[model samples]
Target: MELGQASAINFGDAVAAPQSGRRAQEPAADATADPGVIETSIPFRLDDLRWSGFHTRVVLALGITWVLDGLEVTLAGALSGALKASPTLRFSNLDVGLANSAYLFGAVLGALGFGWLTDRIGRRKLFFITLALYLTATAATALSWNVASYALFRFLTGAGIGGEYTAINSTIQELVPARYRGWTDLLINGSFWLGAAIGAGSAIVLLDPAVAGPDLGWRIAYGTGACLGLIVLVMRMWIPESPRWLMVHGHPDEAHAIVAEIERSATGHDRAQRAGTLPKIRLRMRDHTPLSEVVHTLFVTYRERALVGLTLMIAQAFFYNAIFFTFALVLTDFYHIPSDHVGWYILPFAAGNFLGPLLLGRLFDTLGRRTMITFTYGVSGVLLALTGYLFSIGVLDARTQTIAWMVIFFFASPAASAAYLTVSENFPLEVRALAIAVFYAVGTGIGGVAGPALFGALLDSGSRVSVFAGYLFGALLMVIAAVVASRYAVAAERKSLESVARPLATME
Candidate 1:
């Protein structure tokens, strides 16, 4: 076996041994004699697994985390005015903005803490634990008596959902076949918009005086978000752990058993068809890798890819948080649209976002990653600038402005979703989840925190030019990101994760 240079390590020739048959014979019981390094080949059978109801079930069960987050964040934005107007909790506009920031802050911390644990322990354990945290905090948020309590619960809720991003994205990438990975990730990430639409509609009725009083309606909204998590948890219990993670952790037998089970289930009792071929893998396992080595792998070994991931994450985070968090404010303060009716505008905006991924995701697999990602990011950024200009010059009313937003985000949504896919797929399996958390933290911290606060202040200033400037700033970031991606993005549309970034376990 020959290890390529550090600039780009090649796994092509690193498979030191290969057996003739589809499955290797069971190893000796004393295979764990020395824990320093253990070598084995657990076939990459998952890449070839046929799509089935099991895949659909897993996508829905695990992917609901994003939906819950979307619902939570959107609910907060929609109900900002109501929270301020409430006799029980009179939150200021800045207070409402701070609460949103608190949630994002909690998410950043959760991603860092839970992300490390996900890589250290296992995806299955952390996912269940994180979801429980989210459900508890969200349900508690419903009963908050004041700003402090609401902010605290919102932070805790963000923590749970933030942790979900690390665990869920890594799990989905490892489990789904390479061909389906692109579409699956884009659609799953895009589901956040579905939740946004639902949250908008819920706030509409819940905030109505006839439907429920001002005091009670807001509390019910928070409680309702918790219900979604409970249903997902039930479905998640039945899904198996990632075989890829198990294989690299020196449990080849367990990994093999799970993969075999998946194969059988995918084929459904077909005797001959069940014996499909899988990629014979060679993994060199280490009990623990120092943080220094992990950092080296990301920044030194695959530096270009790291740049691409960071650019994608930061750009999308800033663009999304800036607009979505402040959107209701724009409608209410600028256009005089009623808070309750804000849901009506959100429905169309959410539809455009949902359709972007559903419609454009397949092209990612066919046309390739770099081309499509660049196209989406570039187009969206350009359109956003045009929309911002229109808004500044008083050419766009509330309706036309929304139509413009719908058009802009239609391209941006899939591009944003692809940013997640980029990070998850471009890193090695050992530190995949942590890489996601690190980039998500840095990107969201810088972009997410600043974007909302800046825009909120701009909306309050009552100057069209100033608010338009905020939009241009976000637009510039996305365009810069597109340029970076064009140069550094990986052409990893249909490739297995191993092929894209070899497992840290692979060695000469």
Candidate 2:
């Protein structure tokens, strides 16, 4: 069978059979057994999902960080009206959007800066530092007496979790086996919104103007986020550094030791026997290649790769920011609803955000990266176009509009997630962090910041015609993103991550 083409494999397939039931009972036998816990899917399956073992605890830890991510992004929109009610803050709509941007700026700097740190120091240490920064900032955000203080705290919070985009994505990318990478990343990534949904729910009941007092509700909303950050920090203490990471950085001994530790844990054995578990191979990451050569090679080495990474990133950043944020505007303006009521409308969108990644993620390891992107984005572009037209004209009522947007957002989320999984897998570990940094810094950082900024400007213009025009602009960008993807993306579907890292030219 070819790499992605095998007997039924989904996210929840049976790649975990014991090497003989005998091996199943022995702890030391785990290393030699199917260490496939990192990723279990193989060939292809109809329902793809990812389950973590080595970093299962760490995945939970990252999920908590995302809870914070969801809380902040969703809260501003969810509680905009409540915020406006505050006598002390006197916040404006654009001011709220800009605070969101301030958060993105911190995220931008954090993604680039901490990504370099991931390469310099290591994933484990940077994880603690970044988590702490975001946690402290989140707590401070809840205490802001004025908008400036709020924005500053939000920015710092962003800077801290900004490292999360890299730490969790890259760490999981390296730790897992190739077969299950697609769905695993998607599921883990989707957890961000699970937290967001929780945040949205929290705001409706707790921050509603009718219930909690004016300023107190917004403060409590953000303070809940700060608490979640602290819990994630505590959970992270258990996760070890990546063994693959250890191997490449000339620590074969430590790498072996951790691998053995995992083996001992899995097969059920003594910790004493887990010592000295790594293979005898030591990898040094130094190559005399010039900086220009590395930059040139990312494109020159594979034109298709460059296209895949860039287009998918652009499409994801553009559509997600546009759709997710703009929907809030629609709720606030078109529905003419109160801030807390916006939470009711947000459920559909949030549900979509939750499912899309889960559904479409499996295709990366099976149908191939190219087919998934082309198919997913192609469908997603159509969905977004329909949604805009539905709202721009009076085709649907406010409630219907919410439902339509939900369907589109849910379906589109998976394709967006594949972009990250594809980019992370394509690069060798040596340059993996760099590739991720550049891609996200441009896509998530710049694209994320601009989509809202640009759309908010269009929404402010006086004409009804101008309003529809803004959505049209977003539709056009999504179409452009899909077209670019179709032309440039590579079909790295069935290939192992290792094989993907080594180009066809190299294989040839």
Candidate 3:
């Protein structure tokens, strides 16, 4: 129950104790005290198994992080006008932008901080803890009496979701079978759009003057997000720690037990069908991997791969943040669409974003990571460039512009989701969570922060050419990232994580 302490979690009838407290003072070579080394072929055993009811539970529980994020983002965009109109908060247009920025800043910090703990403490503990933070903070947001309080609550909410990224994404990647990894990861990430659509639909109802007053409507919207977080929290409690994480941390007995239970759940009495498939591996179980070794793993041992991840992350962050945050402003300002009606347009856009990942996910495994990453990023970039050009020339109206955006994002969403998938899978299991945190923090800090600020300024200028130029800049970044991915993207499709980047402590 306490922070930084290990807790035992129950999964069905089996219980596994996650890593507890600091192992910092322990010597790495003391094999007898902490069980020196384990070489695990256990993960491959999982890779060979067929999909089951267990996998479904894991995906549904873990995948909601993205959905909650999408929902929050959509709500923020849709309710901007409502917030500005409210007598209670009396927020300005710029204030809404600042609140969003605060949330992102908090998320970046949360990812780094909780990400380190996820690698050090354990996965199961962090997932629910982070969700609780989101639930508490978002519920508090509904009670905000001023702009400052609202922004503070939003920051905490973002922090909770941001932490979820490191814990959930790493856990899912480690647990799911390699054959289904691409599709599963894409589906989970794309589920964010499902949240986005829900938020949009909710906003249309909540923002109506007849249904609710301006002051109460936005408060209810915040409460709705909090309620969803509570639901995810209950589901997350049913999930367990990553067995792969257990094996790396010198608990192979516990790891094997957990995997055996899953196998039983997956196979029932048919366990003998794949009874001998697990491979034996030897890995040195140090109480902790030194910080220097983590740095070496990410930047030194895998420098080129690290660059590819950074490029992809920065480009995608810029593209999504720049457009998504300012989408409503563009709709209302440039095309004269009513403020309250923007949610209707967002629904179709979210649908396009969701479908891209669903339809194209399998190709990441079938066609290969390099080809698919390039095609998606490159195609999306070109489409965005052309769309921006059309808008600048004054040939498109609100309906046509929305249609163009839907098409551009149909490809862009999957490409963006792949950026998360790429970084999470590229590093050693020892530092997977921290590595994801580093890249996410760095990428979101640089591109995510700058994108909105840059576009907000451009959008405010009300110059068609200026805003058009911002879109081209985003497009150019995506093209550059696609080129980087082509050259350095790991041939990781359907391969085990250990194979993609061998664990640092792998012994014989």
Candidate 4:
């Protein structure tokens, strides 16, 4: 497995071939014509591809980013107890919140910077850069002696994960066929809970006084992410650059070669005969899209979709980050659950989160995107409100509170995953990655960055009412976003990316 190797074989046949012994005509040359103009059916080819072992590999290699993020977040939450009780670093609730905020703030910046480059450079190139950064930062996190050092390392780690979101999401969207795209994307994004489960299990063993004391357990937990990252780097070497991206960026020959290779792997022979019937799209190739055009496209050309993406993203970001980041604090402060036992509660919670998308994901493709997204978001919001009311009144113990969360997030997990799916798929190919970054940055900046810190303060006050107020606000945002999504989300299920949103460079 090397760079440019045909790792994730996409669908469909090669470029449209000649019919009845007549060769296809190239774009006619004119003085005013764009020199890079060419016709291709690469998008169709990709969307028509059947699922194969190659696609499975791509899902495993690329989708691991979400798992790593889940692990990081869960560890942060699970280890809050250890961090606070540490002899070397006694972090207050506000300190923990600030650290979590710093990680998100770094993610916002990382997504903006790396996402811009993901669109500029090829997706394959950025994969290693982001993963390498994550590996180094997470490894360094094990060496932190104080809160400042820990926060700095965590910020760097977040930067890497944020960059991974843009690059990996773009690649998954481009490579996966349209029929399987919705469920595939949801399941992959939801795989984060798998990592959460792993982290919880790891915390249980590592934090145990018999195995390793509080100080060493948290350090070892951070080290595990770096080890997993190394394995991911090797797996990614087999994945080639996106053919549709290549075809649009003046590399039609390379695009054709990759697709042909994939077809051979998929069908044991080139289905060149069928190419004649496939539709073609003419594009004026460019090295990169300008920032001005990117801004205009997001805000003006697709303003309505942009609004929907923003609302969904902001609502989910706050809803998830506020509660999950401060999960242990809530349990410890209100319920008096010991730090070591937190992992037991997290296990059931993680199971529900993961199962949400696994069980409900197909409905997004079948019942349609708008219907599923709205239902998930609305249900999650309503459930959170009910759970908050219970918590505030002291009617729910730790066991009951964990049960409540397990039920609530069964919907919220898919709702959160849908936010990423919506943003990545609704935009044009030229700006897809950047669109994800912009929405993620803004959504996280406003909702994610503030949510944890605010909740931490509310929890620090030791007042159930204050925490309930925060929960209510998060619920309100989710409901409002659900309304917006119902009204405006693109019904992009089972449609080709090009058909859903026309490419910017498409020539009439």
Better candidate by TM-score, 1 or 4? 4
Which window of 10 residues has the lowest lDDT sum in candidate 2?
40-49
Residue pair clashes in candidate 1? none
Question: Over the stretch 351-402, how does candidate 2's per-residue lDDT look in tens digits?
Answer: 8887877776786668776666677777777877777776666677778887
Local error of candidate 2 at residue 134 (angstroms):
0.7
Best by TM-score: 4
Per residue, candidate 4 scores C-alpha lDDT tens digits across 1-508 of: 1211221222222223222222234333312233466566677777777998778989999999999999999999999999999988899999999999999988999999999999999899999999999999999999999999999999999999999999999999999999999999999999999999989998999999999888999999999888988999999999989988887777777788898787777767886555545666767778899999999999999999999999999999999999999999988889899999999999999999999999999999999999999999999999999999999999999999999999999999999999999999999999999999999999999999999999999998999999999999999999999999999999999998988988898877
Model 4 lDDT vs. the true structure? 0.89
- In the predicted model 3, the residue pairs found to clash are 31-36, 38-282, 38-283, 39-281, 39-282, 39-283, 40-281
Q: For residue 501, give model 1's deviation from the true position in Å.
A: 0.6
lDDT: worst 10-residue window of model 4: 1-10
> How would you encode candidate 1's per-residue C-alpha lDDT over 48-160 as one tens digit per residue?
66798878888999888889988998898888878877899997767777888889989999998999899888899998999999999999999999999999999999999
Candidate 3 residues lying further than 4 Å off, grouped into runs, are: 1-34, 270-277
Assess the local accuracy of residue 440 in candidate 2 as a C-alpha lDDT between 0 and 100: 76
RMSD of each: 4.9, 8.4, 6.2, 5.4
What's the lDDT of the predicted structure labeled candidate 2? 0.65
Answer with 1 or 3, whichever has the higher lDDT: 3
> Residue 401 in model 1: shift from native, Å?
1.5
lDDT for residue 195 in candidate 3, whole number 0-100:
95
Clash numbers, per candidate = 0, 10, 7, 1
lDDT rank, highest first? 4, 3, 1, 2
